[model samples]
Target: MRRAPWIRLLLWHASAAIPVLGAAAAFYGPALERTGGAWPAPLDDVYIHFGFARAAALGHPFSWIPENGYSSGGTSLTYPLALAPGYLLGFRGAWLGLFAALLACAALLDLCRSLRRLLEPRGGPGAASSRWVGWVGWLAPLFVVAVPLLDWSWFSGMEVALLGAVLGRALVAVRRAELAPPARRPAEQLRAGLLAALLVATRPEAIALAAPLAVAVAHAAGSLGAAASLARASLPTALLLGAQAAANRAFTGEWGAAGAVRKLLLSNPYPTPLEKAVEVIKNLAALRVQALESALGGPWLSLVLPLLGAVAALDRRSRRVAVPLLLGAYGSLLLVALNATARYQNLRYAAPSLAMLLLAAALGAEALARRGRLAAGVAAALAVAALAAPSAGFARQIDHFARASANIAGQHVEVARRIAARAPRRVLLGDAGAIPYLSGIPAIDGLGLGGYRGMPFARASVHGVPAVVELIERLDPAERPDVFALYPSWWGGLADVFGRRVDAVKIDDNVMCAADEKVIYEADWSALAPPGERRAGVIDEVDIADLMDERAHGYAFPSPRGGWVIGAVLPGGGDGAGGGGGAGGGGAPRFDAGRLIPEGREQSFTIDAAAAIARGPAVLALRTDGGGPIALGVAALRDAGGEARVEVPERPAGRWSEIRVPLRDVAPGDRIRIRSLLGTFRSFHVWLLRP
Candidate 1:
């Protein structure tokens, strides 16, 4: 290692980091990490992507029409970034992920060049230390930019790393000019101004790099050719804005302003913008500690570091340059009161900012190093550690996703094969995160998740029995899928909606809720005697004493929507607080399941959906041992699908009876599944002819 040269060092860096980067990119880095796929809630961020792919293949215009739950309301800024690239490349998240990784790597290499120059022997004014320059060259970028957020740069979509590279090059040009002979300064200025202008194209903030950059470039040109230099620098910004203006003028009535944004950041309900900005501006003692933690990722804690670093960067030339850069960064991050205000600068958001700040800090650290290598090492360590902190969690997080993806990928492949074998013609999917991409079937956006706020998707029950049934009812016949590939989450949530006639023919620990009598069961099992019985007159053998029937017919009782309820029914006591009772004083309902029923999605459960109806009437019918199909309510597990069986102990045997179920029941046309908190669960079964 001691004999290792620059190439060797570079290779070492690549060897150690690339595998980690590749794993992250493949699993969590879908669309380069910005779209969080490696998490439990992967679908929420990039729902529209899968929808757009199949939609285009079918010749549907990539029109403003959005069926995914994404609101296509105003000029949603998350668009161009969110939708445009997918549309342009005819690609989806995974495809984009591959592209993002390459682009970012290229940009990072260029940034390394700028960093090397800043740290080179061209010492600052009054500081002519050759050793200092050498140290600066190597440590500036390593400590400042790349190491801090290098990991993050690999995954984010919309080219943040590329923008970072451009910024790095221009800043390097500035530092290079600072040391150039008086005669060569003008040439340096032109390089800086030109690079700055080009960077503006990557992000809206790049435009601000213009004014100061133009003057700086002209200064490098040696003459007061500031007018011409500024003109040239301004050209890119003008043309870009001009094109937007022309399009905006042609389409809507606004000038270049994208007027689609309507709400203020204060209202978003997450880490409010006011709180975040205050956090960024007030890196006082206590807040400073907090910012340090965010350097790893608290509501984007890392983002504030850049602003604080910019505020703290000293030295005359640095002050001049950092002021404009900081202004533009802050303005771009917080200027929009109503834009798609992404917390782009949180701790992880701080990665690039840290990179930029490192350039200046390297210059400063070199001076400090003169006191002693110890002082310089301490300074660099602090900066580098702060930047690398948030990325640490990413390491743990990436593996968790990689393993999960490996499992899910297998499920997706099997699910796709099953769907292709069964439903061949256009398949409809529920919770379509990676499935549609894995399967080649033309897909319909299930929940409109990608465009959660404005994308138009028919909201139905979750992915369970009822949701599947409801979904089937809502889809067009052409798009009406016979085979439904559902995430266990969706299926589990809506499993109770259909009863229990659901099955797992295609995959184990998985289900196939269909209506085909040949090889499939239906999602709609409401008319079935029991929730999961395939045959009528089947008998489950659990203790089923009190059954609630106040709401009548279905699982509804405590008002609102007629749905299921769960709680420990107080034995011999009557239903309390919005509950009705049956013969054994057990027909009411209580207990908040800690979940709410949102519009567009059904709310069902896999537990014993109990209710106490009047014993004198039909209250104690299938108390515990009604393994046999009862007259009106839910049936035993046998007749419904999934070979589901509910054990009704000798009804009226014990004061309180517990109904034990073996299989899940479901509704017709639904495919969602459900489970209990303990992971131990049984789906509902439906008996078509009242058992």
Candidate 2:
């Protein structure tokens, strides 16, 4: 009359999958209906993976758009690879989301089975015979699937669910190895290593979990020396991680993926190390606060359950499992908090970590229940209350998900349709995901996620509009996007300079979009050559504002000083405090982009001025923001060195001006350096001209 072990296992997995599927249906049903049966993901980022998958399916792995040639934009390399098979098998469009959903559900089922195994006793008589234990195991999965954020992540068409599943399996494998006899530990260790590698491939942050789990596995393999054991347990992970880095380097010219370079604070071009450290600390604090508030059933239960789980780790019998679980859970949370985007998108980055903590809490509850009938009752009450606490938020999460999906469908998808109808060559846009995928148009990501040579764009965007303009101006002209679809508010300067508005799409009641409106424009590059008098004797021009140009000119922020950072002056003089011929005044400056040379700091550029030297009466022309005066130092060093300084007077604030400093006996390899004698000022362009 007793159910078979396999039957119970099957039932538990089925039970766990029911809520996940039900939640998916409840969330996606209204969204699909709202979009008129068109599938739209809750996040635009979902379509990013679809784009990569489609490229991979067409035999171009790692490329977001096949023509873009090798992009490391997809964060989860394995997820797109997983979805690629679906694309090959004819699961296109709406069916793609369904395919992803099935994969997530399968992962959830696997996670449930792993959790149930972790909940059960290792090996002994009557260990598997307890009815209460079986019921608790069944309820644990329900608790996991019931958390609103986890459910949101599972159905969001991202890699969160698969990550959880792989992480759970890896933990189970580590635990099994710990409990195995010495003779059997090596095989278990190898299995754990393989799963850990897969975990990293699924999500690179899984390295935090995998590293601690490796240490735990090594501790268990006592007969093998610690170094050998650690190597054995960690070998697969290191190799896989190394291979990913090598592949990224080979294709993208970066060791890290484009997503990491664009999103992580560590990779950002911070002017100072101290500033980077401060920003990182702030991000970590913010993520922790968010987790405490919304990660569990509110702050109190969130604090209590994890504490109880830590308490359960005191017992030697439970220490083996509890220690590793605790480390992996908290470690994963710490790792994700370092990301700039961790606090956004409903904390999707932290979902896998929360699941691990919840599972650990469930185990702790089971441990408490084993003490006495009173303890068991108390544990049962707490567990049920924790599960019920998230119910209020569950409905809200579902509504948000559906509404977010609707927003993407109405805005990005509609824009894509319009764009496809136009069929322009090489579109440029900030939101790069759904539009590029759905439209089948070759596009450049203005935000740099999926663009060709996107890093410069990413850095330029961070600095401001002037930097973006300088970079765009330097482009080969043929490579510039002919059409642009962008949120005008996000790129007003760029739009004004190069885009002629064609159409716009607006979405209302939006919960998840960068802006309310996305405007389409025909790119007008004529602005690159603004109508102005050409300087007749100009021999060389260097755009000091552009990072690429700065490097090419051997530009350097002088030693023992704070480095200069890229800054921009918008047309109309930014905030509009009028002075002289600045944009805020009666007229706009010819150039509005430059690098900010801080007060009392010098910036130097090496110029090969051989032609200017050969031409009689050569001069150096400097274009600078008119707010402050500057001192120019010229050093001529062909074989011997001679130096001279020239001072320029300041003009009105919020304006730009050109000052021509005559050069006497200037040689071929002369170095030009400028220092702000007054307050910080922007250096727009430097030109060597023959008078």
Candidate 3:
């Protein structure tokens, strides 16, 4: 006897859950054994969500650390809120990750059920009631559960499974709306809207899928008109997304969340629009290639799946469903392409899109089965062939997940525990995941994913150490970090500038940590002395190495012909001791960092001489890295008049040299222009001194 529908649904879920749960066991077994039974999340980023969930459970949503006011760092506002209940129920420490895994498992089961319903034949006079149809329904869910990458995502303690489930549910709702009668269309559209809202709240990129689904709903409205249906289908998502933007702006002073700002290529600074476009295209192309090899099961599946989707779309009966699914799959891939980290963590970013493509392929299989028994057999054979490679590699993926989890445990978690033992007031670090979450210590994310100064810190880190030093010096004393834990290779210059190494964590056979070693440093801020405490006759001092500071002083390289390199450090060491030389002094210049201006380039700085003790003639002192004897053409412009050009003769090479340009008729609000007429040299410090 055939099973009842509910019983069959239960069986489908059971089949899906079996592999999922078994995979979870296989992944966690080795991870726990390696970490001495301390459960470690496969990726350090999972702890970031845990931190946000802990804050939310404590009545402070949107905060990374409850003590720190508000942080828009959590990527998914709803994921953390969903996990908050676990925290409230005392799922602390490793249990919280288990709770997340359980949530993901439940989501995977729901996704499987949704896919079965989506692929099942609808009731009609000639609808296929063949035994093969039932088998297809049973196998579709199993096929989804079988993909190694998707299974890895399901157990990774991230939101990938939840996103897939919500997207699946939304697709089903939209499909129902497409088939429903005009009288019931609005209600189904509303249902889809609510699900889309949930999807967007889970991951903002769901708009890629949700958008086309909204259009599908509007198309289904037919003669009834699209406005009402479109509104019903789009309202919830619009409101949720708008509220999220508002909250982000109110808390973090940015319209986008901290995590997105830190990671998206769109958020990075580009010198020109052409450069940005070229880089984004290059990145997307590379990501698509990677997705084909891994995320889409294999390169062969990439070709076969799209061909199947096209076949389904060409079929008169399946065209409506196939078109929307194709659009959604393409959109999802495009969304993943925009992500800077799309290639990392086993291509987790592409998992949702993979689900979409698989669903479309399932539809194509059903369309083939509708033709004849022989065609049905052919479709079944194709399905097996498509899945063969991914299924074969499942064990290897499981091993990778286990080792990655162990890596996080041995590196990030171990370091966090050690730092926690110190009881430091505030810790600063680049990898802002496990340390803040596991240690429960306040933190400043040097990469800016979990802090209020996200934009400045992110931009400074990209510009290199001199800009970072300037940013650190600008911070209030209270906000400055006391303990620094960072990868020496990643932030070596920063380590040299403001840190004294006190401890280190080294891990072996590391597959996922940024580096094998994470060094802990005690901060040393003595080198950043105030300008007033420096030299007696100094009127104004400009550190040309600091990009933002230089920009603030109207510093620029005017010609496209000559390139400028910011934060250029000289090879020879200077202690960064302040105030060692004046216009004619022989003492070595203390500054060791500068901007390297190429030959024939003009560099200009506008100084407010009103701040000087007396606005008379001043000595323009240039501390430059010694390469060769250099000649510079210097001109001064004042509100009253312009001064004659002064030529600065080349000094000795192979060391740091101070070249003095005497300014005549200097007054308040004067602008100085300096150009390298002969040699390409780095200018370390520019000073205006009382003559």
Candidate 4:
């Protein structure tokens, strides 16, 4: 604890930080400007926690939407609680997020220092410290800050940095005591237990990290007797976790957070437990492959660090702590890998494993340094170079993240602020991430990712069909979004499908819900009107529907007519929709898309007969096998189109209605098409009539 050593350590920490932070600043500078003074994290999920923190700071429990009561929307119980103070002090958005990450990194540096001190075997009878111990000690922290993935995690405003620091601290203390078991400090042991508790509270996943640490701590505390020491080490953790579970159960009616359950329900690949376990192994294997691919560019550096470290840990000098450390790291990783099946999952899932490997490498480097100056230099240089590519990769990643942040601020954040200013409090909306957080209103998430209530809809499988439409249709009447600030593609067709008149306030390109007005518009119907046909308008009905993609607000399913149905509702629509093979309802098949167009909405079909249509007004007609109220709009391809609903006084359930639309209503042109603006008809057709 000499001043010289402390000062040298401080300088080394600062040296490691400057370049990494400089790269971050370089990326964040323009981002800050683009976001209009608010720094946004790259991931929208970060804002979910920020919102929770903001809510918690206001003396409420963690909630993105307080109006909807407590929903375990935040990923970590402790992180939002930790971030609450920053929000109370008025550091909002990316600023608050960065502060939390930086705080964790500081803790990380402290843990690294403690680890270096604990691992360096100071002047034992056979112990010889390496000449490069001082420089090599700083390498771990340097590697952490320099790597893009690790560095970004700290700034991404998640629990990674905090988890790293807490886990690292406990491991360091455990290592110190394991090395000198006779001098087991009860106070240190209790503190490690508390840290472990905090780690678990930060992320339920840390339970895996804690399980091994518990064994090691008990093993090291043998002097105090196993049971007594185990109790001392476990009591605090158990109490903390039990209390959290009780609180969550009381508030959210679930153990842990509903979010985790919801995620598992949504992502779980199999129906049965045994199958799920098998799938989990496959997913972990896949993740391993992905991590290997990522490290292929720097295989020697990546491979050597962990291998040398693991090998060094077996040496008599480092065996006491290194063995348990390696076991815990790998054990936790295996557990995480088994549970993590996200298609987009990456190496961050195995952060603790990586940390353990790095520590082992550091120990290995120290041992090599003990041999000679040349060996130490080579070891340190190799380790540094190994991390260099990742560091550079992360620097570029920061730039990409900055741009994404800017986009979120300009679009989602700005729109959220606007909606908050205009929309009613507690109104439900779709795509409920940033807007709900920024607006301080409850959102009925259209995509089903954020809030717990939307879990069913979020997890709903439309079997490669349109998820948004099926989700909107399935949502309970009470849970339906009152206002939507989503793209036209999301809600334009929704108005027709649901029979709700949705007035959209155009906020740039994204649509804002204007709830007071009962006016509904589905995309720009005029835009969908064939622009003189893509090729010659094929009179094929199936081909017409196939073209309406997200750009066209259309989803395609199979049509019984030896073709496909675009955005059509098929038979067997009930509670078990999309669950299995259809249990058919004894009703005529229906085509459903756009909002539920109860009265009727426009449907367009391309006509190939341009010359025939030009010669005379097209007689637009449809033979409905069953008809109540029928309507059709006929138009030349260039015409604005005209609507005509047939009045069937004797409405019959199973009778054909031969309805006709006049050519006078349509502007003169060749390639004519038809639009069903209002009313219902089971099926339709058109033909050119000589004037």
How do the residues 274-297 of candidate 2 rate in per-residue lDDT, one tens digit apiece?
776676677667666665446566
Top candidate on TM-score is: 2
lDDT of 3 by residue, 40-68 (tens): 58888899889889999999887777776
Better of 3 and 4 by lDDT: 3
Tell me how far the alpha carbon of residue 285 in candidate 4 is from the true structure, in angstroms, after superposition: 4.5
Error of 3 at 164 (Å): 1.0
The 10 consecutive residues of candidate 1 with the worst lDDT sum are: 542-551
The lDDT per prediction is: 0.39, 0.72, 0.72, 0.53
Residue-level lDDT of model 1, residues 1-691, one tens digit each, is 3334577458545643454345344545442232234322122123233344334434432322233322222222222343344446655434644444455556665666655555444343225555433444454434433332334433443345666677778777766655567677656655665666566544454555555555544544445355665565455557756775665444433243322222233322234456645644443322233323443455554543453344334544454455555555544433332233233222333333434444444445544454456765664555555445566565544444343333443344345556555545544454444445545555554543322222123222221133324333334444444445554444443333332334343323211122111122234322212222222222211111011111113331111331232212223322211112322323332111112222222323222233222111111122211122221223322223432222222234223323322223323322222222221121122112112
Q: Model 1, stretches more than 4 Å misplaced?
A: 1-100, 123-128, 144-158, 173-235, 245-292, 296-312, 324-351, 354-360, 370-691
Q: Which of candidates 1 and 3 reaches a greater lDDT?
A: 3
Ranking according to TM-score, highest score first:
2, 3, 4, 1
**Pairs of colliding residues, candidate 3:** none
lDDT score, candidate 2, position 154: 82
Worst 10 residues of 2 by lDDT: 576-585
